[model samples]
Target: MTVIVRDLRPDVPADTEGFARVRRLALPYILFTSDSVRHNAVHVPAEARYRPLVAEEDGEVIGTAQVHLAHDSAEPGQGLVNIYVRPDRTGRGAGGLLLRAAEEHLTAEGATRLFTWVLDEPAHRAFAERHGYRSSRSSHFLRLDLAGAALPALPETPAGVELRTAADFADDPRPLFELDTETMRDEPGDIDVEYTDYDAWIEQYWKHPLLDRDLTVAACVDGRPVAFSVAYTDGGGRYSTAMTGTARAHRGRGLAKLAKTHSLHRARAAGLTEAFTGNDAGNDPMIAINKWLGYEICATEVRHVRELG
Candidate 1:
């Protein structure tokens, strides 16, 4: 069987379904849907030169890669390529072809460095190393039994504090956007990003297919949001925490934990059976909060980087 790498045809439903299928099989810890696949392909910034490529073997899409430059990063010439192949189709040269194609595209776009995330399994790590990629930091995927797990009771809001949902800001989401940008600025990562484009944020985040406005709990202090837990549901009894953070002024008050706990209760009440979340290995505070909520580590992925001259 000959495997050919080509751009994904978003207009074709089968193409989007196949891409999401490969990603779901390769990384079950994260949520993927056909709509999300198409959204990413269409809404990606022009400067990033984003391309979603799929590897086809005899008319079957067996692998996928999301390649793009880090447009929002303060430093230029940095690119990212995340590749995933169907679990049943590994070792068929599909992955190597996808990687090579992604590298060529990124390099042609003026990329001076390439970064990727590989699951921490031996084979995955070996594959990255073989391609001249070096291991860096790692992140963990956590899972919780939302339906049957014993979630902690929602705590009473402290003085001058209130709990709300993202839906409350529907009239004007600018406040939530500002809060999200502030929190994201301090998030630990290999790349530094600035979210200044409101329209892009609205298209990419606020209107995302999976974002459950009602389940996204926010902590308000004197009528302003101080912390929040953004929730995403797959409409299939699966719910995930996309982000949970507290503003710098609210860090010591346990508002982050409170918002997350409230969000989990809301999710379980809504009949979601499984909950998923991810965290950088070094984020101890969030890890502790997740552990307290009965989330267990399900998998780990290591960040890999390659410098291109």
Candidate 2:
């Protein structure tokens, strides 16, 4: 059977469902829902030039690719293409077709560097290398059993610090935005992101369909969010931590841990059975915190880069 690659139709229920299905089967460590897939395709920032692609075998989608420019990065011409193919569908050329299509699209968008993530398996790494991509850094996908594992008890709120949920900021999320912007700058990655657009953040993150505001715990000092654990629920008893960090001024205060611990407990109480999170391989502190919170390294992915002149 001949496989074809094409842009994803966010408005089409089958397209979105198939895309989400491919992602879930290939990378179950992360969360993906058809609604979230549609939301991302519809609400991506204009500068991102985002294009979601699907590899179709006859009518069934066996692979997917999320291609876009790093619009938030201070450096220009950085593009990202994350591709995933169903395990049972690999070696059928769907992955290659999707990667080539994504590369061609990003190249047309003036991307000088292309970045992608490949599973640590030999076949995945070899496939990337054969396409001129080189390994840069690795990250671990962690999982915690909220329903079975013992979660750390939420500690007492330190004096002058209050624990709150993202829902409390419904009237105004600018404070959380500011905190997120500040904390994200220090996140370890090849791309340096600067979030100067508040409205974009609200549209892309704060208002995300998967974002569980009621379970997103934050540590506030002086009524301002200083540290936070962003929570995303799949509505299927599964939860994921999208981000967890402390503002620069708030680091070393254990506020990040406090916020995450509280968030995990809240997720468990809310009937979330499985929890997932990712950390850069070199991020010792966050790794330690996840381990302490009962997370186990379930999978790893290596960042691969291909530079185009």
Model 2 spans with C-alpha error above 4 angstroms: none
Using lDDT, give the best candidate's number.
2
Q: For residues 12-58, could you state the per-residue lDDT of candidate 2 as single tens digits? A: 99999999999999999999999999999989999999999999998
For residues 1-309, write the lDDT of model 1, one tens digit per residue: 899999999989999999999999999998899988998888887888999999999999999999999998889999999999999999899999999999999999899999999999999999999999999999999999988889988877788888989999998888788889889988888999878889998988998888999999999988889899999988889999999998898898999999999999989888899999999999999999999999999999999999997
User: Model 1: what TM-score?
Assistant: 0.98
RMSD of 2: 0.7
- The global C-alpha lDDT for each of the candidates, from Candidate 1 onward, is 0.93, 0.94
How high a TM-score does candidate 2 get? 0.99
